[model samples]
Target: MLTRKQHELLTFIQTRLESSGISPSFEEMKEALDLKSKSGVHRLISALEERGFIRRLANRARALEVIREPDTASPRTAPRGPAPVKPVAPAPATLREPANDVIEIPLHGRIAAGAPIEAMEGATMLPVPAALLGPGEHYALEVSGDSMIDAGILDGDMALIRRTDVARDGEIVVALVRGEEATLKYLRREKGMVRLDPANAAYDPQFYTPGEVQVQGKLAGLLRRYH
Candidate 1:
């Protein structure tokens, strides 16, 4: 029998996997369980693993495999081996692959690294590898400036954006300024202001009140075409 907290955590993990087809990150699980720290989530996951309820793969972030669901009638048995490790998308230049599991995302036109451009929505779909994208809803944006050049993002590059409204400090984000303008920049939240810092030093950082800034999406991967 599972404890109340364990049951809740397992249910959350199973639900996320069914809905998004990916394991929830530690931060995500922590938030869902209303825990103060990821350590609490880690402990619960460890307990579940030892009880043959879940399997955690080594050397991978968010590499969790839910072997069985709570309230199921099957007997609890330990996983035979480690989970397969797959290459994940990092916040840098991406490598090309032959063919893999592809998912389609909406191409939302271009975003500005130099000047803030109007975000446009279209009916086109962009195919990207599922392994690189992980899970959750995603979209693509064509970059159109040089302010983020130092961050391996250049003009004409296609940025794979995981749809999100919340971003941690130092994360590259699509921030909507004053509810109208949107720009791609490194996000930092001060006591009362939201700072959008450019990767290149030539440009100055822009700041606004917290209420004036809204995060649209976060950088997940980048697609560049070599001429």
Candidate 2:
């Protein structure tokens, strides 16, 4: 038997995975459950996992799989309201088995590897090996400068970025500053300020308030073409 919130979350996840091949983010789950914060969603997810209802995919951001659905007929499921709707059957195995193939992801224009620059949006698409990506939405950015050369991210290399709004400290991320300019740098938090660190010693780190810096994605892999 599962709690009402648990059942609702599982159903929502299953529905999303069936329609779109990716799992919902923690923010989406929090909003769907009408919860106060993402912590609440974390607790619910942990509970579900402990009961063998779901499994988190390893090495993948925001990835989840519904291992088994709760028994809907149990008296403890709803207790008062109408019986819970049975979850739709899991998607076919063939639909979820292309993790090792090639796929095209949106290729957003160049991102700054030196100074902050506008990350232009366009209709370009980048063909990427699926093995380079994990279980989340992804996009590509063309590197434009040498600030990240020390990180082995050279000029003109294709940066494979996984689309996500949250990242941990010291991780290389694409950060949007003041909702306008975007740059690729290491993310750090210090004294209530967000720090964007460069991999090269020639440049200084940039700092902004927490609200000014928005995480767009993290570096998943790099694609370089030899001349």
Candidate 3:
């Protein structure tokens, strides 16, 4: 079993790897662990490596490969032969794979996967910040009509909208109309009426009945490609 300090260091290292898509450097590990000396953290890592809990690439930065971590259960306390180590747990199928290895189409908006393309409210995918998206913050959007010409956003552009149920008026959002078809438009509610205004003049504003449109998330950011 790892000591408290070792556990904390391991957690930090693992979380850092998951967030940064890379292992923590020695100095980073030392600083995170708040150790008085780099050697102290080094000793813990070396011990873990020797025990086959992790493997490091030679002369590589943040190239740690986790082998296996001990199970949470305590030892049986009987002098049994060498205890077999536990295995790494599998990731849930529902979760998206690393964006670096796979194309994570930002859940900007939901289109009719089977029918006409409509704004998809309640994003099904998200962009993780620790990598490109913020610290524990994520965004999702439904690609709607484009109004941001100067911003380089075009129609069908995947909007990496930051997930926020609450946002300032005028922020582009993935909104649901009576929980039916979703759309992308500036969210504004006034005098018991909701307006889904498009950024492009080519598209006219959409007025909604009272409590007809619901906001899923605000446009925190956007992504697009040139023709």
Candidate 4:
């Protein structure tokens, strides 16, 4: 038997998928379930997957498929008499193929993961899987340092960036400092100062006046190529 939260989550996912082709994000699931953190939603999803009720698609972000639904009908709704059977036809055989959608975005040279570095623009383009992106204008940047290694962003990783001028606190963003250099760090606000924090503890946070920093874009996703 499924738990109450599990049933509600499954129902919500089904409803969302029926209305829209895209699955809801982890933040949406957490909000819908009135949970404190996104970790709670992760645990619930893990439970559902273990029970074979849903499966996650490979190489896709925010992708989920509901394979089965829970049996929630009550015994009181049982029919009184036996129902008549009808002849059923067999379904036709067909081959299912995976989707291969790729989009090319501008590769805007390197951005620092350690210290602020000059952001160079280039004519090159990077082809990314469509499933990794959401609705927004996006671009790509080559990471050049190890300050954000704790956040799983390594040196030489392709950082997918969504172009946006505004971002909420605590989000990873591409911050333009003094309109010359750019760095990937956690955006935070402190006593009248804009603080850019690094994921690695070895580095200290950089603080600047609000006017010194410009919000260029937010971190959307990442693309890593294995050698």
Candidate 5:
């Protein structure tokens, strides 16, 4: 049996993971639970792990796996009045269809622009304006560097992307280069060379062959929040 707090934590983690493909960070978890210290969060996590409700990936930040979903059923309660009332019948379950006006885009962690960082997932969902969404599947990635600052995409901004394996020349795209690293840059092919062009002058453009670069997604829009 899990405590109320433990159950709430587990439910939050499971809901976040199912929505975003990424797990929430320690700070996020702490905030969600209204805890004053990260140690408190760690203790709750440890308890959940010990009970086989969740697992943590070693050495990975925000790496969490939910082995079991939290029980959503509420416990039965005794009669509060005089205990002379008749038995009450439970209401019928109703199916809820997902809202169509708004779409929940998965935030797949951060993508480096100045330098390639192995992208991480299990991030939270961002409900974006439907008009800003383009064709095909859409997802969001937090930009982590200033390489694309000249294009108005700065560090800590979210890059909305439409999933596609192909990109036109001069289109800003998320490209997987050399099957190892991924970067956000303009995709341009000229003279049989594929160039990952950065918007900022401080960084030099990276050049590769068509076989070395794979298009992951093209930029659809950008979302920034001023703190």
Candidate 6:
């Protein structure tokens, strides 16, 4: 059950939304709850939000909204979690969960060479979506050479690729060819063959027939960490 204070706060929010067709301000919530400051109301609201009762939107002041009514019935019967166990215990033997501390990277589908990037479905990659990388869904690749040193990509660096099937003929990409191989190269279409040009002049440009070269993904961003 809501210890009376929570109930009062929720009721005030519900009422304001019903009356104004919009959410109430934090100050209003404090006034209704007789809180000395808005921070007290803010904490309670955060608690309510945690419990699935509301959500806070970004950048708007009148930002509170009730998502679900609080379940205030039955006085919270689940016995409060065994009192925080005494001391450290050995890990159970059969419970060897491989630590996937490596957050599954979110991956967009691969792009094809010489074509506009297309939406990829059924190809989901797990990634920490919080990385402020550039546009489009993200994928990763092993950097091959240092030609892009001017572009900051180094060999052995993990490039976060974005899915795109088409480009302006000079974008770096992951190209798959009839050789059943994938490589990072600049895509260029000249005459009849699509040219897979390496950024490093030491490596020569590879050519392909009309249907020989396919782009799997384009270079969007890179991640490198020392071993």
> How high is the CA lDDT of each candidate model?
0.74, 0.80, 0.56, 0.79, 0.74, 0.57
Per residue, candidate 1 scores C-alpha lDDT tens digits across 97-195 of 233334567888888998777765564777665445544567889999999999999999999898899989999999888777778999998778888
Error of 3 at 111 (Å): 5.0
Summarize candidate 3's per-residue lDDT along 1-227 as a digit string, tens digits.
56666666656766665665567665677778888754466567666776667766444434566667654433343255333467664221232222231113336344321122455444454433222332123455434444544345566565665556676677766676787676666677877788777656666677888577777766655555567
> What TM-score, to 2 decimals, does candidate 4 have?
0.60
Candidate 6 lDDT score relative to the true structure: 0.57
Clashes of 6: 18
TM-score of each: 0.60, 0.59, 0.46, 0.60, 0.54, 0.44
Better of 5 and 6 by lDDT: 5
Q: How well is each residue in 1-227 modelled by candidate 6, as lDDT tens digits?
A: 45466667866776766665566665567778888864466557656666666665443445456665544342334365211212222212231212211223444443332232332334454443222233244566555546555456676676677667676689987777764666677889999889887656565678889598777677766667798
Per-residue alpha-carbon lDDT of model 2 for 1-227, expressed as tens digits? Answer: 67778888988898888788677776688889999865467667777778777777654546678877754554364667544444445444433422333456778899999999989578487776544665456789999999999999999999999789999999999999999999999999999999999999999999999999999999999999997
Better of 1 and 3 by lDDT: 1
The residue ranges of model 5 lying beyond 4 angstroms of the native Cα positions read: 1-101
Residues 1-227, candidate 5: write the lDDT tens digits: 66767877877887777666566666678889998855456667767778777776544445567876533543122234221212222212232222323346778888988887766457787877543553357789999999999999999998999889998899999998888778899999889999999999999999898999889899999989999
Model 6 TM-score (2 dp): 0.44
The candidate, 2 or 4, that scores higher on TM-score is: 4
RMSD of each: 12.4, 9.8, 14.3, 13.6, 15.0, 18.2
Q: Which ten residues in a row have the lowest lDDT in candidate 4?
A: 83-92
Off by over 4 Å in 2: 1-100
Candidate 4: stretches off by over 4 Å: 1-96
TM accuracy, model 5: 0.54
Q: lDDT at 40 for candidate 5? A: 58
Better of 2 and 6 by TM-score: 2
lDDT value for model 3: 0.56
